[model samples]
Target: MTETLPETAERLTVNTAPNWRYMLQEYDELYRYLPAGGSDKIAGHQRRVREAIARLLKRNADVRLQPRAVKPVTAHLRRALDEGRTASLAPAVRALDAVAEDLSWQYGYEKVPKGLSQNYAYAELAGTRGPVVAEDIILGVVLFAPGCTYPAHAHKGITESYVILSGAVSENHAGVYVPGSMIYNPPEHLHRITVGKSEPALLAYAWMGERENLHEQKMVFTRTRK
Candidate 1:
């Protein structure tokens, strides 16, 4: 039986440390799937991912974690998980369960290109959120509903990487990235993503660099969906 979304979020209290532990543990699990060739591309990302998590763990869980309204696109989360693209990601999938329902899933407004109907919900687990996990680096999950297209955008002084947990995504002019694909973008590199229409796409993205310069990133949408 499919587990329904829980309405009552388990009160995290000030004991969100365990939750953070699970989150980091999930990121660490990515190391288990490295290619035998030892691609330096992925290796570098793994290191940064760990470093970001480490920095986040040092902060205080001062703010209360609240459950936000679930957007209609979140309904596809289960479909993405059930697709079973990568079993090694089971733990990561399970981790989302603990917090997915509470996510403030919403459409990109100011950042989206003109007239594009893309909806995304991201939990900046570390830094950028209420509690502020880390300042220089960020850890978060991005959900793109099927048929949604994330317009081209770029960041300044921030290097970004996206680890596909399930479904598929195409970074404009870069080609399609499926399960287990590690797509990275440097600061000021303009890129866009389109999700498969039949199922939703979920990506665990990391941002490393100057946190103060993050605002320098903005959407630059030039295409319209036909």
Candidate 2:
């Protein structure tokens, strides 16, 4: 039998810290300040992200510490955080640092491409598999080493968005997205990311979709015919 959200919440209350709770609040702030760029679609995505976060906050989801883990790319985390502290995403970065030791960074792929493992990794802040147990939304951050090129990929049935917190990156070579920029990708929208050469990049992302999809989504890169 599956555990209901209320039951999960009740069982998780004891281990959650005040800092974890504050992190969610900071995330709410992060999404709240995102500029819509005069696009209703963008505004709608922002609204959904904030509203989902609001719902999670209202439920007071438990935030228990996961086992600490790291990746080669995380070595750049310190620099990213340092840069973010003075950037517009300062609040979110600070809150993330409070629970940094407990974050479990992963590649999210069954088979990571060569060199990619050392260049990138992501950690979930709130989701079905994260410190916060939620089914409707996923909140996380991805870190990339300088000059990293993340291969083309897309989330099936998931509408996603990323807000650059530190350094700079270009998605599909469209433009350089500096700190405080927002990028939106609808479901199954193929896209690729490349980080700037001089500094590591950190981006906060959110995914919203059906409960089943949100819980069971798989990660796979798009391959091109040679």
Candidate 3:
């Protein structure tokens, strides 16, 4: 039987909208296979992120197409993806690459700091203000130009984790992280990131917090006290 026009349109929408949801599935796979390194804290975090994504998938959240935008730092995104494709985290990177053109990169600051204006940006994939429209968890990617220093910052009431997908970064001068490594930061834990000088770094991050806190989350750099 010939389908009605509305039925056909709905089927088309369903088929075409799987791109973003596929990206989320890739994220779940990435988290599921990541090594916990025997740290119970990390193990728990990984499990929670995977479970939240599972629940989100069951809900079949609608995908909202963002107004495509780019920044100076995005010039390195291709290189980042290329490098990421050769790493252990290739699948996750490929998923992001699929939707790269639709991503809306922003500095997430009201008044942009000087040096950072051109070197760093983030695109949210799922959250209160992102395409997926969720309040319990936020998933996104952050890109950094070579030799960029992301000033010290902390998220209040939020436990955040970053999975390095490409290039390398150092957190608080503590250690260098390569592709497929996960860095975890508890709520209100002040941290700084510095990308290596040779290539851009791309990181996938997840934020888990109370509904109100997740909805009202703000990004602010810490003041340097002399």
Name the top lDDT candidate. 3
Off by over 4 Å in 1: 1-17, 31-42, 58-63, 84-86, 106-118, 215-226
RMSD from true fold, candidate 1: 7.9
lDDT of each: 0.65, 0.88, 0.89
TM-score of each: 0.76, 0.91, 0.93
Tell me which residue pairs clash in candidate 3: none
In terms of lDDT, the poorest run of 10 residues in model 1 is: 58-67
lDDT of 2 by residue, 1-226 (tens): 9776654454553134677778778778777787888989888888888898788778777766578899999999999999999997888889888878889999999999999999999999899876887789999889999999999999989999998999999999999899889999999999999999999999989999998888889999999558
Which of candidates 2 and 3 reaches a greater TM-score?
3
Which candidate, 1 or 2, has the higher lDDT? 2
What CA root-mean-square deviation does each model show from the true structure? 7.9, 5.7, 3.0
Off by over 4 Å in 2: 1-16
Per-residue lDDT tens digits of candidate 1, residues 1-226? 9999869855542245465567666776664464424667657766766765655554433334545756555666777766633554667777766665555554434654443443665666555553333456666778777777777677767788888888888888468887777787877878888888777888887777766665344434455458
> lDDT at 135 for candidate 2?
81
Clashing pairs in 2: none
RMSD of model 2 against the true structure:
5.7
**Candidate 3, overall lDDT?**
0.89
Question: What does the lDDT read for residue 70 in candidate 1?
Answer: 64
How big is the positional error of residue 85 in model 1, measured in Å on the Cα after superposition? 8.1
